[model samples]
Structure formats: structure tokens, C-alpha cells
Target: MILSQKLFVATLTAMFTFFILPLFFVEENANDYFIGFVVSSVTIPFIFTFGLLTSMLIGNFCHKYHLKKIISFLLHIVSGVICLMIFAVYIFITGGSPEGYIQTGLMIALLCITVFFYIDIVMKKKSK
Candidate 1:
């Protein structure tokens, strides 16, 4: 179940970042689909790899310490902010456009937070 939750969070993050968010920022071009495909090919794997790592770390930490709901929520928020900072630095280092970095960074943060929340919700339901 924990493994499934990790995969779910990674997949959800990749899908939203690759498919949905681009709709708002990318310009229409003859090769736009191809470009998107290329980008996703690169990014999806990256997200999955890191997403799983981060999610597992957080999940294990929460479980090990047996955190309360409010503390867990705060921990997730801090994780999100850390993720956002890392993402921002990554984009800057990669020379990605400034215009898109803010949105991408925020999306990354949201995705990080969503991972914990989704897992918590699912675990709650399972326990019941």
C-alpha cells in the first residue's frame, strides 16, 4: 500500500506537470506535440525517481515518529517549501525561462504536499 501510494504520487505529479500545466504556458506550434513528448520523456522519469525518494522519506519519517495530524500537516508544508526551493534552484541552474519557473516551482510544491495528503487520506480509509 505504501509502495502504491508512492507510485500514485509520482505518476500524478508527472501527469499534471507534463500534460496539464503546459496547456497554460506553451505556445501552439507545429512541433509542439513532439516537443511535449520529448520534454515528458525526460521529465517523467526524473519526477518519478525523485518523487518516490522524497515521498518514501517523508512517509517513513511520519510513520517512525508517529506524528499527529497537525504535525504531519506542518511537516508536509515544510517539505513542500523545501521542494519549491530546490525546484527553483534547479530551473535557474538549467537556464529555464524565468516566466515559467514560478508556476513550475509552485506546482512542484503542490505536488509534494499532495503526496502526503493523498497517502494520509488513503491510509485513514484503509484503517477504517
Candidate 2:
């Protein structure tokens, strides 16, 4: 995929994972948590920036070694792990509650995988 497509995917995945997904997972203080997330306005950009940069680096590495199929599958896994780590760090840095961490982390991982795979499938179909 091109850089532009990667960036677009990153932005979409970040937005969906951080913004929309949280609404369903956060049981307590749903409004407050979401409000805090929106008010901070830092999480989205942070996720998107790191997600984009890391995916790009991984893409380049995969291309360099000509491990397209293996790396493509690994890329989704890596992205999910990277996103989970970023979320954990962000939560720690902000002193957010640990209670919802697992739920949110799982959501992030699943969303990342879903979005990346969906995009990959669509792109492949388009190319074919």
C-alpha cells in the first residue's frame, strides 16, 4: 500500500478504536470518560501518529526483505500490539483507571486487526 493509504487507514482505525469503540466498552462514567477523552484531544493524534509511523517502518522492512505475505499478516498483529502498548502507556501517563484497561486494550487490538484486514482485503480486490 502507498503511504497515503496507510495514513488513511491509521487515521480511520485510530478514530474508530479510540472514539467510537470506547463508548460501548466503558461501563462506568461512560460520559465522563468519553468527555475526558474528547476534552484532552491528545489521544487520537498520539495513536494516529505512532500507528502511522510504526506501520510505515514495518512496511518498509517487509518490502526490503521481500517477505510480503508473511509480513503482511504480521503487520496486522504488530499494529495491534503496538496500539495496545500505546494505549497502556497513555493510560499510565494520564493516570487513568486500571479497571477498564483490559477491556479497552482488547477493544483496541480487535479494532486494529479488523480495520487492517478489511483494508487489505479491499485493496487486494481492487488491484485484482
Candidate 3:
């Protein structure tokens, strides 16, 4: 359990870096890059934390209401997939590269860990 918690944190930190690194380093224009950096800094925390917090709350609500974990997880995953697909299309339309989606996946994996950890800290749940 301790190992999993440590590992979860480690993975999340890595994923978060993956998501933010390109925005910090890879813009064609310096001004645009700075804007991206500022945007990333301001938005990432709110987005990651709030999304995790709400999802964890929802998961707890489901658990309390006797929904099976598998079902709840599947439903959440399906919704995530649909959202990711939409994001991918938008990125494509906007001329973002495939690597951006890969990075987005890292961001998502980070958020999943953040959600788990939020529940862990708030509800004292143990990682499996």
C-alpha cells in the first residue's frame, strides 16, 4: 500500500511534467510560448485538482449508493474516451500534432492518480 502510494505520486508527477513540458519549451514563437507557459501554470492546477476532486466525489457517491466499482469505472472511462476523442478532433482541426494527444494521455493518467490520491487523503482509502 505504501509502495503504491509512492508509485502513484511518482507516476503522476512524471505525467504532469509530460503534459506541461512541451508547452513550456516547444512553441514556434517566443511570445506564444510565454503565453502557453503562463496559461499552463494557471490552468493546470485548477483543472487537475478540481477534476480529480469532483471525480473522486462522484466515485464515493457511487460507492455509497451500492454501484459496482467496475460499472462506475466503466461509465467514467467511456465518458473519458468520448471527451478525449473530441479533444483529439479539436486538436487536429487546430493543427496540433499527434504527440499532443500522447501528452494529453499523460495528463489524464496523472489526473487519474490525482483522483485516487484525493480519495486516499480525504477518505482514507488504500491503494490496491
Tens digits of per-residue lDDT for model 1, 23-54:
55567785977876785587566655665676
Residue ranges of candidate 2 with Cα displaced over 4 Å: 12-23, 26-30, 68-70, 93-99, 124-128
* TM-score, model 3 to reference: 0.41
lDDT of 2 by residue, 85-111 (tens): 766776678988655665756765676
Assess candidate 1 and give its TM-score to the true structure. Answer: 0.62
Clashing pairs in model 1, backbone N/Cα/C closer than 3 A: none
The TM-score between candidate 2 and the true structure equals 0.66
Which pairs clash in the backbone of model 3?
none
CA lDDT, candidate 3, residue 87: 53
As a whole number from 0 to 100, the lDDT of residue 82 in candidate 1 is 66
- TM-scores for candidates 1 onward, in order: 0.62, 0.66, 0.41
lDDT per residue (tens digit) for residues 41-62 in model 3: 8656654555444455556677
**Could you tell me how far off, in angstroms, the CA of residue 28 lies in candidate 1 after the best superposition?**
2.8
Candidate 2 clashing pairs, residues 3+ apart or interchain: none
lDDT of each: 0.64, 0.67, 0.56
Which 10-residue window in model 2 sums to the lowest lDDT?
17-26
- Kindly give the stretch of ten consecutive residues in candidate 3 with the minimal lDDT sum: 119-128
